[model samples]
Target: MWVLVFFDLPTETAKERKIYALFRKNILKDGFNMFQFSIYMRHCASRENAEVHIKRVKKILPEKGHVGIMCITDKQFGMMEIFHGHKTVSANAPIQQLEMF
Candidate 1:
C-alpha cells in the first residue's frame, strides 16, 4: 500500500511559510518522500500501516489550507505514468520495506 499526501498551504506571510515548512518537515520525518512540490508519498507494508501514517498526517494538518490523503494499492501506483516535457519518465521505484515478524 501507499499513502499519498497532497497539500496546498498558504505562504503569503512569514508565519504561513513557517507553518508550511513545518508541515513538510513533519511529513518527511514520517518517511514520506518528495513526489513533487506539495506532494509527498510513502510506501507502507500494509493497509493498517498506511492508516497509521494517514492519521499522523491528519493530526498535524494546518489550520488553514487544503490537504488530501489517498491510499493506493501497489498495483494501482505502478500504473501511474510520469513524463517530463515531451518525454516519458518512469516512476520512482517504491522503497523496499523490511518487515519483522
Candidate 2:
C-alpha cells in the first residue's frame, strides 16, 4: 500500500508559516517523500502501517488548514498516470524497505 498526504496550510502570518514548515519537517522526518508541493507520499507494507503514519499526521496537523490522506494498494498506485505539460513522468519506482531480522 501507499500513503499519500496532501495539505494546504495558511502561510501568510509568521506563526502560520512556522506551523507550515513544522508540518513539512515532521512528515519528512517521519519518512514521507515530497511527491509535489504540499503533497507527500510513502510506501507501506499494509493498511496497518499506513494507519501509523495517518495517526502521526493527525497529531501534528495545524488548526487552520486542510489535510487529506489516503491509502491505496500497490496495484492501484501503479495504475496512476502522471504528466507534466506534454510529457509523462514514470510513477513505478519500486518500494525499498530495510527489514531487520
Candidate 3:
C-alpha cells in the first residue's frame, strides 16, 4: 500500500523541530520515508502494517496541529492521475451589452 501524509503546524520557533522529531522517530521505527517536508509517502507490504504505522504517527502529532492522511494500494496509485482543465468561462463580465440590434 501507498500512503500520503500531510501536516499543518502552528507558528512557533520550535514547531518544525517538534514535528521533525516525531516524524523521525516514527519513520525510523516503522520504516517510512520523507517524501517532502510536512508530507510523507510510504509503502507497506500489508494493510495491517500500514495501519500500525499511521496509528503510531497519529499518536505523536501535536494536538494543536492538523494532520491528514491518504492511503491507496500500489495498483490504485499507478492508475491515479491529476487533471488540470482550463476554465471555459471567464471570471469577469462582458464589458459591452447594448451594441447588437
Output the number of the TM-score-best candidate.
1
lDDT of 2 by residue, 1-101 (tens): 99999999999989999999999999999999998999999999878889998999999989999999988888888888999988998896748777898
Model 2, runs deviating above 4 Å: 98-101
Runs in model 3 deviating more than 4 A are 80-101
Order the candidates by lDDT, highest first.
1, 2, 3
Give the alpha carbon lDDT tens digit for every residue of 37-58 in model 1: 9999999999898989999999
For all predicted structures, in order, the TM-scores are 0.94, 0.91, 0.62
Which 10-residue window of candidate 3 scores lowest in summed lDDT?
A: 89-98
lDDT agreement with native, every candidate: 0.94, 0.91, 0.67
Which candidate leads in lDDT?
1
For candidate 3, write residues 20-64 as lDDT tens digits.
676666765675566557766677667886788788777776767
TM-score for candidate 2: 0.91
RMSD of each: 1.1, 1.5, 17.5
For candidate 2, which ten residues in a row score worst on lDDT? 90-99
lDDT of 1 at 30: 97
* Steric collisions counted per model: 0, 0, 0
